[model samples]
Target: MSVPVLLVVEDDRALSAMLAELFEGEGYRVDTVYDGQQGMHRGLTGGYDAIIVDRGLPVMDGADLVALLRSKGVTTPALILTARGSVEDRVEGLDAGAQDYLLKPFEVPELLARVRALLRRIDNAATVVVAGPLRLDRVTRRVSGETPDRAEVELSEREAALLGTLMAAPKRVFSRAQLLASVFDGAESAGAVDLYVHYLRRKLGKQVIRTVHGTGYRFGME
Candidate 1:
């Protein structure tokens, strides 16, 4: 399975380093930023599976960052970490679009558990992914074009995973290295990405994925 990618937005350098190490040790790919502005930039474009942010941050507050991300249609699950314990503070975080909240000085086990829970919720809700004319049923590993006459096509596990990764962030172009890491878990060489793209095009049509010359590939058929 592809490792989950997490973004940690904490101003405390020590805490951020600890979180990066913790999640990485748990087999997740982690990206850390020290302030809310950087958090917002990364969160908008990183295509992360989950984000952990501190409530008080330089440049922008975590709540505002979350709200802005939601406004931009970034549905990646977010958890707020803060020292504030007020019921109102928690409400504000939730209302601003965070899926979970973790208070500071929390037990490591509980934090990990909560993160897992958030991921589980997202996984449950993400059974179906629709991008343009394409619809993917992750459970069935089926890709179907929206046209009435287009028959659904079953994909091998790797092909399905690769397509799912591209479709997950339709606007983002992914490099071969990124695809290799995300879908193949770096078990396969980067050339494997090209091979699979050819396979998908043969099955789903040439328009299913677009190559961006030097950059990599992005979701096509829009």
Candidate 2:
């Protein structure tokens, strides 16, 4: 399974290093930047699952970077980290497109929880979704499905996410563009969606994902 990638934008050398180490220890891919200009450039170009930004940055400031990304339709979730703990500061950060705001002096567990929460929001699959004999566990990022030989199989993260999306609205056809926008986080292509559908079908039987003929795909038991 691919590790979830993160971009950390912080000017404090010690703090930035600490965060990168912490998140890496937590089984994530981390990229650290010392200033907002570099951060923004990386954030825009990189296929990051989420971003952690400090409010007071040297070149661009965290809020402006986040707001600019939002304006340009970069939907990757962002968390604001700063010493400014006022209510107004929190609101401003959120208003500028940061999903969550955390004060600098925060516990590691709380930060982990907030980051997980952001990921769940992006997944939009916090609850389990079921279709036929298939069950997808969002929390575990697992899919319980029977193979042709009647054995159960565990799916990868992307597979589970795609299956959950299809099961979320069962029998409803989803276009490639729509699936691309919802499922792929800029790291995958539209062809990848087709490939994943083929993968799911192979795992759960060809009847699992139905082709909608020139439109896209749908979920149903054959």
lDDT of each: 0.83, 0.78
Best by TM-score: 1
Give the local distance difference test score of model 2.
Answer: 0.78
What residue pairs are clashing in model 1? none
**Total clashes for model 1:** 0
Predicted candidate 1 versus true structure: per-residue lDDT over 57-117, tens digit per residue: 9977887677656534477899999999999899878866689999998999999998898
Question: What RMSD, rounded to one decimal, does every model reach?
Answer: 11.2, 12.0
Q: Which residue runs of candidate 1 sit more than 4 Å off their true CA positions?
A: 123-222
Q: Please give, for residues 32-131, the per-residue lDDT of candidate 2 as tens digits.
A: 9999778877887898899999999996768767765553346689999999988978877776668899998999999999998877765443356566
Top model number, lDDT:
1
Model 1 global lDDT (CA atoms, 0 to 1): 0.83
